[model samples]
Target: MNKLFRCCGALALGLALAAGGALGAPTPAGFVRAQGTQFTLDGKPYRYVGANYWYGGLLATQGPAGKARLATELDFLKQHGVANLRVMVGAEGLSNGYQYRVLQPLQPTQGQFDERIMAGLDYLLAELGKRQMKAVLHFTNTWEWSGGLGQYLEWNGYTGQPLPKNPGYSWDKYRAYIAQFYTCTPCQDAVATYIRYVLARTNSLTHKKYVNDPAIMAWEIINEPRPMLPAATPAFEAWMKQTAALVKSIDPNHLLTTGSEGDIATDNDMAVYERLHADPHIDYLTIHIWPKNWGWFRDTATAKGFPAVLARTTAYVNKHAAEAQKLGKPLVVEEFGLPRDGQTFTPAATTALRDQYCGALFGMAKGNTPASRVIAGYNFWAFGGAARPVPGQVFWKPGDAYMGDPGGEEQGLNSVFDADQSTWAVIDQYSKTIR
Candidate 1:
């Protein structure tokens, strides 16, 4: 609704429940870095196919019910060769937003932190470390879920303003208003404080400070951060550069990324993307292909049979890869997905189209393109494992199963379910080839 949103064997080969307690991550003892349009892990090429498990930390609860589900999901992913995870560490106090946030009120009041969610993250990192997996942890968001821009505005005393579709305003107008976060003094300080808090805190379970933890591959400034209006470009760029510098100044161990949805920059040129990423602090580049939202294809909710959509997607990935290559930074198509064949959310829906599209993208990551290996990897739009939203439910309610989806994304529209063996088979086949 808002945007397009590691390793081992042996212990990794065990059954889901029996694979518990697999020691700390077996990754090389250093962080990842950009090595000429490719990532290097301990001086070796780090080519991998990762999954977007934004709800991972939240799912690692001490409670029995959630813990079992979390175990099952992680084991399933590991069994199929998933090693890199992209997770959401962003959460704001509950807001009046329509889609009730899953993990909310992390900051009950401005500048105050929530210990509960912090422990949840601690447990998550501990588990990932045990499995020898790597993670990309994103901090903030441009959208509503996880208490992003709206919460920031409300916290800074700019309350009650209409957002996008509210009464009379447009999305760009609302985006310009949210753009206030780049320059607002109080908001900026609040974020810096949040960053410092997380970077310095030691994981309660792992007992390792976040800055020194190799379990994390990178720190994303925000999810899908962008300059909404033309005039907001300079300010956004300044913010991006300053934020990257600040993160590096604090944590020199992990890689950094802007989480920008590479596009024709507000300067009306794609070169702006390359220029902004030119900052030495940015270790890599990312792009999100929203075939449904971007109109490259039709969603099943309305129509069907857009076979040519995959062709358009291929071109987009290549174009962005060429741009990333020019900057000499690794590029990740970290977000892309197609709806199921008929766009059905029912558990019985077939993912034939989705599987074929994934195969093509995975092929590109594994050097099946004109440029031959310009893209390192890709994470599909989302993965909804072992979860089913309440029958006929529209908006996700509290305590509904964690489905690897953000609010407002139509239920099951893009989720790769545990039951989708065809999709998993495609993923497993690519797992050995993507590097």
Candidate 2:
């Protein structure tokens, strides 16, 4: 038997003996399992062809209307062959006063869980379960609500245009805050408490009914975890190790992933990957990739060109996959996208760029040695009915000219959305069959 299969067989045997069940019990349909460098769903190799739902969880917190909206969005996604939905769970939602700035001292008698946020999550998961959809639920926000300094400043209303100056905080003081935030002790234990809560709820649901529901693909430790200040590596690593251990202790049947967006280039990046891959509790590795200066769409042609971009991205994926394979796991490209900055790309160039980038990556995956299947999956940056009209932001609402036109001035030429039936047809052709 192949070594990876043997490892998995051993794991299955251990779980069976521990549960006092028969050997060869069938894994659930739509379940993802390691197969060489790729993942197999329902015993068949599959690749992700999906879109991100950034505000799904946020909107789902609004009660009945929010639940209805979520159901509508998932139905649309299912119709479009979207096999996954990447959802965000902002840390702000968990704690009342834990904004982006300096961490407030925790009161001795604070509640451990946030009932409103938990109720929203419960509703979201119930909806996903009802639809039989899979979600890559990011436990933290990478944008304004990220952990550490970014979130701190954002909470204080520091826009990216005018980055905030440090409030003269000392590293020693900050380290203590980090410890509390990660541990959540005396303030209700943030990371460990949240993971335990999720596991308990899901396990209870499994025991009661819907044992086969695959509502969540994995628990993402943090969204785009990066060291804002010097000397954060040790603390971050310790927190990750402890959190992973705590999560695994409760939910051994599901998987765990680190939501590291691959933009921060540092020794810490490789170190984080190494630590996560070495930990047996982590089932997969995930990274996000957007071309250099992609936000500005600078060097539109070169940035969007197939050869220029794919070289670095493919190399990054390969390196991570190699690391994950050592630990009997798969590397998943959890997020990748080319945002349309208002200026640079004329309608024609924009459409061309999109097609070329998507096609090139798909082609490369097919020809590569380990095969893209070994890389688990790829989720596009986003999908929504209407885009926000911010100038530099990725999603912009359709202008008057393109109203009611599905093609929207680009016919699979260079845009992110599927321009024609042909674009999605091509995607279906190259992507691993996921149903």
Candidate 3:
């Protein structure tokens, strides 16, 4: 438990009193709190090795089979020292009829929600609370896989529908269109309504209000929200601040974060990243690293390219850690992962390169370096427990099981499965070091 939670609360009252000025009371006994540059649970530093189990809530909505799978996965994660889970509260706009989107979205229409999906999330939180684990719930997404900002744009009568996987639209076209979400009044309001509904909800299973649940560690503004253009920075920053303030106004106990991919999401400008996180309401800083997506690694030369990839990752994380230190906030590498060796998207493939990369990155979190010290935790790309990828399937089909990768990516890519013993060994070694 100490290895999983990383909390030292022997002198809890003194620590809580000292830190209480910045964070007021009624936070509940075990809720995670942000103090200066660290996370605290019961007034002790709370750092962790977590997983991004984004589909947990949706899976829990699947009745008996889904609930059983969710239970097994939660137990597996807890046994392996995973104490925090980063999950989507729910997806949006599935009713848009997109060919590729989150099935059974919690909010399928403007100003309306599906009660079943909401109850699924309630069950998931109740389960997490049962295990004494924490969760970071993402309100919505910026990308198309989950019917996020683009869907909002479409709902608001914006021109050019989101075409993430469509052949007719280019990636730039999709980005430019969705970037308007920062300035879209109705779209923003629609999301605000969704946020309020989720925050004010009471769990049917636990009978605890969502705002008062200690199982939830924080609330993320959106998943990977990017400015997309330099000119859009002001609007993007404004949106972040406004949204952060809005979340704090309703729920002051839980921490708030921007699900940013560091400078990459900020038009590759660190200044923009720092400025956005400097907001008083934004409690912590988060950054994601994607070597393959960022052009640092390639499958053809996996062995040779790995060194450069690790070097670049170190530099990127160190840069963000330094900035986070200056801002006086704890930093979390909330998302980062490498594909299997040779870029194979199958559970049977070797994970040597992936394990090596993950091990080195995890080592940095507990290393003696100043930058490493600033990092509070890491949630790897995903956990795909008991979910087998369909044979010969590249992209997800309707009936396929959920993996670490979303609908937008290859099914098994970057997923750490229950059978991946080598990867779990790497995770286990580091998981024991944080506390």
Q: Candidates' TM-scores?
A: 0.89, 0.68, 0.95
Q: Give the per-residue lDDT digits (tens) of candidate 2, residues 1-435.
A: 246754774575455344533445566656555544555565455566766664555455555766666777677667667767777654442223332221111111122445555555556666777777777766543233224323343333333312122355564444334333332332225444545555565423234222234677767777666543345566656666777787767665556777776434234367666775577777777777777444333454454455656676667667766666666667777666553432232332333444455666555455334534356676765554322223343322323111111121221112334333444565566554432
- Model 2 clashing-pair count: 14
State the lDDT of candidate 1 residue by residue for 290-337, as single tens digits.
777776655464234455676777787778788887877778878878
Over the stretch 1-435, how does candidate 3's per-residue lDDT look in tens digits?
233233343354356556675575454798887766778787567889999999989887788999999999999999999989999988888645555687778878888899999999888998999999999999989888888888888889997774766667786787788779888999999999999998889999989888889999999999997988777889988888898999999999889999999998866788989888999999999999999988886555778898899999999999999998899888999999988888888899999999999888888876457666578899999999999889887887787888888877888888999999999998888888875
* CA lDDT, every model vs. true structure: 0.75, 0.52, 0.86
Worst 10 residues of 2 by lDDT: 400-409
Residue 56 local lDDT, model 3? 88
lDDT of 3: 0.86
- Backbone clash pairs in model 3 (N, Cα, C under 3 Å; residues 3+ apart or in different chains), count: 0
Q: What is the overall TM-score of model 3 with all chains considered together?
A: 0.95
Q: Which runs of model 1 end up more than 4 angstroms from their true locations?
A: 1-30, 161-169, 264-268, 299-305, 368-371
Tell me the deviation in Å of residue 98 in model 1: 3.2
Report the error of model 3 at residue 84, Å: 0.5
